[model samples]
Target: MQFQIENIPIQEVKLDFAKDVRLFVKREDLIHPFVSGNKFRKLTYNLAEANKEKQDTLLTFGGAYSNHIAAVAAAGKLHGFKTIGIIRGEELVRKVDSNPTLCFAVENGMQLKFVTRENYRKKTSEEFLTQLTEEFGRFYTVPEGGTNDLAVKGCAEIITENEKDFDTICCAVGTGGTISGICNGAYSHQQILGFPALKGDFLQKEISQYTSKENWQLMNDYHFGGYGKVSEELVTFINQFKQQTGIPLDPIYTGKMLFGIIDLIKNGHFAKQNRILAIHTGGLQGIEGMNQKLQRKGQKTII
Candidate 1:
């Protein structure tokens, strides 16, 4: 069989407490090795548009361990485009060898441009982009985390006829693009629950910009801390979850979403006999980078 990105199968999750409720996870992580899950969905249409524009280079922004950076790098290589990664944390330029994601991007022929976190915060500003255009010259730019109109268009395909039976849809929300797409594609009667990896109410506004649908809500308590933050308990849960379900989840997103779903189930968050579908938006490539940080802190490493 030929390898294709779409039509990923759903895996049923066995939860003792939620026996009355059906829990299924859309295996989006299996979409690709580097450009898996939401990254694949987010980049699909963006790449198409870039090609249509006859752009020879693709420039984007990300952090030291950003899955988007790695995905963009790989996509550039696979699709025959030069890639430039404007990375956050200028310190990462000196530490590229130690950061797995950056190393992967570099190896895939992505030109790494490091900037301070303060400078990276201006990535969307016209002034900052003008500077980038002056420096790099005429490149198609994908926003940090790959959330844009085209990206949203690609993500909206995540829910199709196969997923129509699920009463509620769930996914780990990062930039809100993936969930917004889900909201657009989901049935009008279905409820979409976003488990944010960061702590905040700000994502609601960001999501609202992409879709007018009011079928979704963000679950704010699941984020162990802000982005890239994880607790030992989360690490243990991720390891145990893999052992039990044979599904490897990245500590940053899918793992937290699953943990929250289970916790919510125990707390009676869902109605009896409700069907739930969770999107396993991949970030497994960043696990190595996360493990390095954990080891430096004398914490339990994710296996």
Candidate 2:
């Protein structure tokens, strides 16, 4: 029952920016083909805890194209546990074929349960969970976006002693677990900058509950519009980036994060001679779903 995930390598990207600045990407995406990047880190302990409790089922929440759902489903399949994904937007129930992530989850044997947006909100409520347990028979519940104490514990390992030379560590923030763990594990002298793919000042509060470190700051400007919202400019950047680096970035997280990092570097946001490391928290599984939307809109798709 080894999960088969491994430590990723750090790749230095030769960007056309200030020569004194060095940019590197910790390729967390290479950890696994399916349960890659931050998802792998976030689920490590949570899955182990479920096994310790003798729970056979893992229940979690996500949207139509949620990386969390896809990762959880894959992990369950790999580790021999039943998985249930409570997806937002009930309309997606009939459109699984059109959605790549959902389809993949179903293919991996994750039981899909579609809920209305209204009911999905109650997923965090005790009453709602009570009803779920009654129907599912004492399942292990993982919070939506998979940000919980165990998730934070797992993410803290993302930073290693070898990477301490970096002056600034950057990552894409989703539910905040990844960055929160990094914030806790990072050196006090290094600053942690999170480029959130979703729009909101609310993540600061959510992240604060996990770690007491003040070394992190969330950049609110990079989220194209909101969660799952992308622009032509972003698509173009993602395509060109892959061409330049041979690294594929997902529109939801890593792509937006790299865009913001390069922009900040070009604008002299970071002082000269700074060492920066960006975490490639993978969400590549959602590219097909995004491309489908782009095709329908007749816009450029991510390459």
Candidate 3:
């Protein structure tokens, strides 16, 4: 299987506060429809390795609305590899039709295997993997969020000579593969700022395992509540940002990251005349599912 990626475009975000501190966004989200953003980057090498090993089946893990699961499914279909998703929450098995992400994965020919939260936690355990191997036969296993050495290598390519002039590089932190790759590819003078979608100090250690660079720092205050969590303020910001910038940000990752970046800019966090490049890692597929939850709660939805 072969894949081709183009040079992603970096568009300037014109805001009032951005006058002194210029803000730009690397539109990694435009890489592909389903296999877009960092997902495309993370899977580029993993799929190559799977092809190298002559593996016909790919198995990975994720939750109901995981971007990784959707990307893997689409990629497998495009590349002619059978895909299997070990989905968290066995209860979601019956709700697949209502969930946009899972539905999309299934439409792309991915076989879904739903497990309880407890079993899902053991997904990386040797015994559990042994059980999966026994049930599904041999397969190339991609970790949750598709973070691995090869994934990091692919993400490192997100930065090129075109981005060398930026003072600070920014991206949302999930499994840390994307940021780690950015850190490795960044110039010595550029600072990498990671806005984690999930709240935890463990990401510092998780990211450190991939890159030894000291140019990156985590902004832990923008998580809203936690992973898969969003608020009215964040929703409003995402909607207004789209109206102002003509770019849509997923509430799970990009929305929070941009929100925090803009907030920082307003509070004079960045130095005057600083050029900031924020990566738009795509998770737009999860918007439908998130809107479903927001509507159920009688809250504002992403527009």
Give the per-residue lDDT of model 1 (tens digit) for 1-303: 223655788999888766679899999889888888999899989999999999999999998889999999999998999999999898877898878898899999999999999999999999999999999899999999999999999999999999989999999999999999999999878999999999878898999999999999899998998898999999999999999888999999999999999899898999988999999998999899899999999999999
* Candidate 3, superposed: residue stretches over 4 Å from native: 1-4
Question: TM-score for all predictions?
Answer: 0.97, 0.97, 0.98
lDDT of 3 by residue, 93-170 (tens): 889999999999999999999999999999999999999999999999999999999999999999999998999999
Could you give the C-alpha RMSD of every candidate to the true structure, in order shown? 1.3, 1.3, 1.3
Per-residue lDDT value at 212 in model 1: 98
Q: By lDDT, who's the top model here?
A: 3
TM-score of 2: 0.97
lDDT of 2 at 256: 96
Q: Whole-model Cα lDDT per candidate?
A: 0.92, 0.92, 0.94
lDDT of 1 at 182: 93
What are the runs in model 2 whose C-alpha is more than 4 Å off?
1-7
